[model samples]
Target: MGTLYYGDAASPIEIEDRALAHVKVVIATKLRRGESFTLSWAHGEGQEPGRSTVWLHPSIPLRFAFTEAEPALLSRAWIEELATSANSSGGLMIVPEPERGGETGPR
Candidate 1:
């Protein structure tokens, strides 16, 4: 598991390390381009069991913490999906996907 400590929230948002790593990449790209968007996810099993969304901005403090020692493989297909959403006015939604397009296969 990993936690994304974001904004004024006292509790960090929990996420899988692999997913968080991918999100980190997408978010960093948007921030670098001076864009802002929403990041949303359905709560994972064993958590609060609801959905959440965050308004991401370049000025907000953000941190990513991973439990795994070594970096997990990424999924480019997933990243493309995320990017597409980020480009839309509706913003990004962190829906689940079977990992693909990283070491698993071509993007």
Candidate 2:
């Protein structure tokens, strides 16, 4: 599991390491360009069933912590999908990566 620490929130958002890695890339790109957006996601199993949204801004403190010692291989299609969401009016919805065959791109 990975933990995303946003600002000074007492509870860190926990996510799977692979998904969180991809999310980190997309977030960094948007924040670097001074773009602001909301990130929405459905809560994972074992907790209260609900959805959550967080407003992401360039000035806010955000950190991604992974449990793995080495970085996981990223999927290009997934990254593009996330980037598209980041540009949308509804903001970035953290959906699972779409399935594709033999296709990979740079991280």
Candidate 3:
């Protein structure tokens, strides 16, 4: 698992390491362009069954920590899909990546 620490929040948002790796790329591109938007995710059914949205701004501090020692491979198709969502009026919506064997793209 990986954790994304945003702003001054003490508790970090937990996500699968591979998923977080891909999300980081999309977020970095947006921030690099001085763009700000919301990133929303639904709480897992095992825990709170609600959704939460976070405002992603250049001013806020963001950190990504991965549990696995090695970095997972990344996919360009997934990044592009995420970029499309980020560019939409509704902002970025976090979704799970496709299955490992079924996924294909750049490293």
Question: Which candidate tops lDDT?
Answer: 2
Which predicted model would earn the best TM-score? 2
Error of 3 at 85 (Å): 0.5
lDDT score at residue 43, model 3, on the 0-100 scale: 74
Which segments of candidate 2 are over 4 A away from where they belong?
Answer: 100-107
Model 1 weakest 10-residue run by lDDT: 98-107
Cα lDDT of all candidates, in order?
0.82, 0.88, 0.82
Steric overlap count per candidate: 0, 0, 0
Taking all chains together, the TM-score of candidate 2 against the true structure is 0.92
Collision pairs in model 3: none
Kindly give the stretch of ten consecutive residues in candidate 2 with the minimal lDDT sum. 98-107
lDDT of 3 by residue, 1-107 (tens): 78899999866888788888888888999999999999887775566788888999999999989998887778766777788998998788888765455454434
lDDT of 2 by residue, 18-77 (tens): 889888999999999999999988899997999999999999999999999788778888
Model 2 RMSD, rounded to 1 decimal: 1.6
